[model samples]
Target: MLRYVINRIIVALPVLFGVLVVTFFLIRLIPGDP
Candidate 1:
């Protein structure tokens, strides 16, 4: 159980990082009018 959770976190970290980076770049590219 604990090992499974740890492995899941390890696998998810890179994916989460990628998403965050992409979103950051997208926000930067978009206009600032909301």
Candidate 2:
């Protein structure tokens, strides 16, 4: 259903943001510049 899809997308947004933030920091923490 359209509502279900929208709800899923809303829920996934925060998780995606978290992943991006964590990945960014992890890459930044690498020994050599990435």
Candidate 3:
């Protein structure tokens, strides 16, 4: 159903955001600048 798909996407959004935030922090921890 459309509702089920929407719910799944809503759940995924936060996970995706968390991954991005973690990646940013990891990159910041690196010694060298880009």
Top-TM-score candidate index: 2
- Please list all clashing residue pairs in model 3, or write none if there are none: none
Error of 1 at 5 (Å): 0.4
- Report the C-alpha lDDT of model 2 over 1-34, residue by residue, as the tens digit: 9999999999999999999999999888887853
Q: What is the Å distance of residue 21 in model 1 from its true position?
A: 0.4
lDDT of each residue in 1-34, candidate 3, tens digit only: 9999999999999999999999999888887766
Ranking by lDDT: 1, 3, 2
C-alpha positional error of residue 8 in candidate 3 after TM-score superposition, expressed in Å? 0.6
Question: Per-prediction TM-score, please?
Answer: 0.82, 0.85, 0.82
**Candidate 3: regions farther than 4 A off:** none
Give one digit per residue, the lDDT tens place, for model 1 in 1-34.
9999999999999999999999999999998888
- Which of the two, 2 or 3, has more lDDT? 3
Q: The CA-based lDDT of model 2 is what? A: 0.94
Q: Evaluated with lDDT, which candidate comes out highest?
A: 1
Q: Model-by-model lDDT, in order?
A: 0.98, 0.94, 0.95
